[model samples]
Target: MIEGRVWKYGDDVNTDVIFPGKYTYQPLEPAEMAEHAMENLDSSFAKEVKKGDVIVAGYNFGCGSSREQAATCLKAAGIAAVIAKSFSRIFFRNAINNGLPVIELEDGVDDMEKGDTVSIDFEAGTVTHKGNAYHFPALPKEVLAILNDGGLIPHVRKQLGRE
Candidate 1:
């Protein structure tokens, strides 16, 4: 179960804005790079976000670069989950690999507003907001196992059982 404050965004929020290229050579620390997260889309994004807030966006979200920093910055900023109409392939993988839940919703982004409260049940593939329920495609069992274990590396480590 994932529950948090919701933040809304539009379509095609690419990775460059999530983690600016200008800061790519700077550092890997979450805090160091977080201030620049979504800089292009919303200059005040970093300051406005609060811990445990979830980001809801329109189609083709995270549409550029293979940088995991985009996912990293969001996690660092304390975002709990990301629900979008569609996602870039690499970004989707990176998000799950880093243990950040990313859900793909079909439509109705315009119906939601920032600061709305949301709850997601990954196992059931259902999202609840203001007493309304929205359904999404269910992830495969294998993928769910990895997510439940808190990401690929950890899931692998558990399978290996190396302490």
Candidate 2:
């Protein structure tokens, strides 16, 4: 079971705002880079976010650029997961590679409110909020394995060790 504080956002939260184009060439340090995450959408986002909070947003989340820093900043900001109606392909892959779970729910944003407590059952692919259950498409086995091992790199390392 994954439980956390919920932070709500609207649609089209692109990558430029997530990591900001200006900061992309700098460094990959999450703590410092996190300062710019969502600055265009909400300047106070980094400060307002609490550890273990989940980001609930509308469709097309993370839709610009291919920088993994956007995912890095969110994880470094201590976001447990992101629940969105849809996600950009690259961002989705980056999130999984970085050990951050992203759940694509058809109507997830509609049922979630800012600051609401949310619980997610990964194995069952269900999200529970205010006594309501929302179902999401199950992740593939390979994707689940990446998340289970704390991202792709660590999973590869573990596999090598076993071999």
The candidate that achieves the highest TM-score relative to the unseen native structure:
2
TM-score to native of every candidate shown: 0.92, 0.94
lDDT of each: 0.86, 0.89
Q: Candidate 1: worst 10 consecutive residues by lDDT? A: 106-115
Task: Give per-residue CA lDDT, model 1, range 84-120, as digits (tens).
Answer: 9999999998888888888999655567788888888
**Residue pairs with clashing backbones, model 1:** none
**Clash pairs for candidate 2:** none
Candidate 2 Cα outliers beyond 4 Å, as residue runs: none
lDDT of 2 by residue, 15-123 (tens): 9878888888985678887777777788878889888999999899999899999898999888999999999999999999999999999755687898899999998
List ranges where model 1 is wrong by over 4 Å.
none
> How good is model 2 by TM-score?
0.94
